[model samples]
Target: MEKGKVVVLEDRVPKLKERRRQKANRRLIAYLSFFFLFILCVLYFQSPLGAVGHVEVSGNRHLTAERIISLSGITKRTSFWKVNEQNVEEKLTRHPEIKEATVEKQLPNTIAIHVREWRRIAYVYDRQTFFPLLENGRLLKQEGTKTAPSDAPVLVGWKDGDAIAEMTGQLAELPAAVLGAMSEIHYKPTREYEDRVIVYMNDGYEVSATIRQFADKLSHYPAIVAALDRNVKGVIHLEVGSYFVPYSPPKKEDGDETTSP
Candidate 1:
C-alpha cells in the first residue's frame, strides 16, 4: 500500500450470514404457509362444507323439477365428490321423454343437471283419454291429461301399430303453422288406399292426404290457401293432384234430386 492510498477490505462474513438468515426466514415462512394450507384442506374435506349444498335443474318442460331431481338421486345430504355425473345422466336418459341429459359439478358444493326432453308433437285420443305423443313417436299414455292439447292435432282413429307410429313420426316434421291449423286427424285405411287419411283444419278447410309425404305437401298449405278464397269453407286436396272442391248441396229439378259435381 502506498502513502495516502489505503485499500479497504470487504466484510464478506456478515454479508454471507445476513443472506443465509434471509433465506432461512423465507424457507420458514413457506413451510408454515404449506402446513396451514394442508390443515385447511383436511378440515374442508372432512366437514359438511364439502357436501352438496345446492342443486339446479334446467331445460325441462313436461317433467317437473322435483321429478328430475328424484330421478337424479341427488339430495341435500349427497356428497359433492360422490356424485357420478355419468351415472346420473344415464339414469335420466333412461326415461322415454328425456332426449338428452347433462350433469355438471360446480365448485364449492353446487351441482347442476340439464336435460333435453322430447318434443310433444301431437296428441292421440283413446278411451276418453288424451295422451301426448312425443316427437320420437312415443305415446305417453301413462302421462295422459283430461284436457285436449289444442297446440297439436288430435289423432282420433289411430291404432297402436307400426302405421300409427310412422304417421306420428311424419307429423313431427310438419311446420308449426301447418300443424297448428290441423285440429284433428282421422286414419281411414281402404282397399284402394291403405294409408288414406283426412285432416280437419281450424281454418274451416279439410285436407285429404296420405301418410306418405304428408308433411312435405302440407308445408305448401299457407301459400295455396293464400291464393284461394278463404271465405269459401271447402276441402283442399293435398294428394297427388292438388285441387279444391266447395261444399255444395243438392237441388230438386222436376221433382228429381240433382247434385253438383
Candidate 2:
C-alpha cells in the first residue's frame, strides 16, 4: 500500500511541473507581444505616416488655393496630431477677401481647408483708380495692375462714409443682370432729393433714382428699357415713378440741309 501511494505522488509531481512550464511560456509570450507593440507605436509616430500627407482646399474664389494654404502655415512637415484646426482657420480668415474659413484633419494624415470669400459687388473710383466694393460694404484697394472688373459698375462721386456704404448695400441687393447693366453711378443729389443718384447704363440709358428705394425701383430697369424705342436714349426717372424723356437733337434751319457734294 505504501509503495502504491508513493508512485501516485511521483506521477502528480511531473503533471504539476508541466502546468507551471506552460504558464511561464504564456507569460513570456505576453511580455514579448507588449514589447513589440510598444516598438511599433514609436516607429509609427516617427514615420511620414504621422505627417500631413495630403492637403485639400475648397470653396475658395478671388483668392487662389495656394494663397489660402500659404496663409494657413500648414505644410507637409506638419504633424497630423499637432495640428490646431482653429488656429489654421483663424489664420486663413485674416485675409481681406476671406469671409469665413474652416480647417479639418483626417486620420492617417490628411488636412482640408474650406473657405468662403466675400463677393465683390462693385468698384468705387478714387484718384483715377478703382477699388473693389465687397458685398459686406467694405472697400478693398486695388492691387498690382488689376483694372476695374467689367462685371461690376464703377461707383463715382461718392466720398467715403455713409453714402458709399448705402450705395454698396443697395448695389448688393440688385439682381446680377441689373448690376451688370450699369456702367457708372454718379451721386447727383438735388434739393428735392438729397439721396438722388444718376446711373449711366451700358445700354445707353440713364437712371435717376433716390437711395431710399434705389434697388426696389431699379429692379424694373430691364422692362422699362424694353418698352422704349431702341433708338431713343434719355434719363429714366425712378424716384417718384418710372418715365423716360428722349434727348432732343439740335434744331437746324430749313436751308441747313447740306447739298450733295
* Candidate closest to the true structure, highest TM-score: 1
Model 1 misplacement above 4 A: 1-25, 248-261
Work out the TM-score per prediction. 0.79, 0.77
Against the reference, the lDDT scores of all candidates come to: 0.87, 0.85
* lDDT of each residue in 74-134, candidate 1, tens digit only: 9887888989999999999998899999999999899999999998878889888889898
- Candidate 2: C-alpha RMSD to true structure equals 6.0
For model 1, what is the error of residue 140's alpha carbon versus the real structure, in angstroms, after optimal superposition? 2.6
Ten contiguous residues with the weakest lDDT in model 1: 249-258
Candidate 2 global TM-score: 0.77
Model 2 poorest 10 in a row by lDDT: 142-151
Q: Model 1, residue 50: displacement in angstroms?
A: 2.8
Error of 2 at 88 (Å): 1.1
lDDT of each residue in 23-59, candidate 2, tens digit only: 9999999999999999998887788888889889999
In every candidate, how many clashes are there?
0, 0
